[model samples]
Target: MSTEAEYVRIDDGVLEITLSTAAKGTSLDFAGVAAGTAALAELGADIGAVLLTGAGPNFCAGGDIRDFAAAQDRSAHLYQLADTLHIFVRALDSAPVPVVAAVHGWAAGAGMSLVCAADIAVGGPGTRLRPAYPGVGLSPDGGMSWTLPRLVGAAKAREILLTDAVLDAAEAQRLGILARLTENDEAVLDNARALARTLARGPRASYTSIRALLSRSATATLGEQLDAERDAIGAAAGSPTGREGVDAFLAKRAPDYSGLN
Candidate 1:
């Protein structure tokens, strides 16, 4: 069958999720939401890593305003949209494997939020991210309020949201929103793929555990976080991969993580 709102393909242990509505600049609607969520869930079933990107120059241009205009109550409509976005963001945040976003061109509003939700993000040097909510006479949604502050602190996040400023890849990197910045879209995808490969070959359980810990640590108290770390360590130590890692260190050889399954 032809791809739906977008396309999802898995190869070489990596799942590549692409936004396919290039004519619309990948603008999201309810159909896009359903398709994207299903694609991501399917990709997570077997893949060791996921790479999210767009098929055209723009990663995404945020919600399709035309769809928004069709709703009866704009406030309720926006809340529904935010709820849909939360489902997708939570899936990415809780995925068992690493997620890398390969950003190019414009990543605005919810698109930027998606990039932030990824475990690692690489952007093209020419890529631009805009907090476009205020510009459109709307407030931030799709976990932007939560993720942005964590990445750049409250002051900078407030400035971005209040002004709806567009940030270049270099500025995004400086603010800790982007993991790496490259000269072109291909380079950004290449770097993300390389990083995903490395993560895929590492201790999968340990990586998942650490991902959970770090994502939750932001709002946790120091003592609560310490307890979480202790619990996570104990759980990891009980895993077969952990034993293999210990044996490898003592034997002076690389761990056979393929046996983790």
Candidate 2:
């Protein structure tokens, strides 16, 4: 784990993934992205949930423009980078456990896409989000086009991309981009972690099944969705954990779920 990019630490059931380079507003570059991906992969097996947040005042300020300028062929380089980013985003979206983004300050460009990829997002009252691609004469990449439309609808996504306007945390929450907003960054991260802890303690298999069903609902027909739901429910009901939960309820005792005797 390089000190340049913050390393992820898994404790109990939660994976705390913090962004380094806070002094630079936690700017995202190739190094940061690589580090993040590695951390997620390393912590995936042990951690039941992930809490993504920045270290300092800002969450992330998009890409490192200096690194971009140094690329020999900007177009080709960017395309390759975009492909890597897509892999990372899709992994986050489809993770067995949930990933929560805790946004404190600026979340722009790729940073905003990262937030959108999370299963849930929380932001501080003063957090700012923006689609800043057009401002730099570059088109959107890094799953922004796919995620923004799904999050805020095509019309609003178009407006934000075309105008590149800044939106506060409350506005983002109202628009459904953020699940909740807190008074400050610390509070935002704490609340997100609390939620993650709760989710981590719940029925893990059922949670993953629900996530898969909902994620595919947009493309699946109503009948297909119904069938999927039925299948998922049946599977959950047959699991030992679910059976234990039911038995515990009937017995008026707490369910033992520590995966140990």
- The 0-to-1 C-alpha lDDT of every candidate, in the order given, reads 0.80, 0.78
Off-target runs (Cα >4 Å) in candidate 2 are: 1-5, 42-45, 252-255
- Show pairs that collide, candidate 1: none
Provide TM-scores for the models: 0.90, 0.90
- Collision count for each candidate, in order: 0, 0
Where does the lowest 10-residue lDDT sum fall in candidate 2? Answer: 1-10
Q: What tens digits encode model 1's per-residue C-alpha lDDT throughout 148-192? A: 999999999999989898999899999999988887766877788
Candidate 1 overall lDDT versus native: 0.80
| Top model number, lDDT | 1
lDDT by residue (tens digit), candidate 2, 1-261: 456335566666887666535655577655556666777666544567877777677777887777678999998887887888776676677677888888888998888988888888989878899888988888887788888898999999999989998998888999899998887667877888888887777666767887899799979999999999999889777787778788889999987655620
- Clash count, predicted structure 2: 0
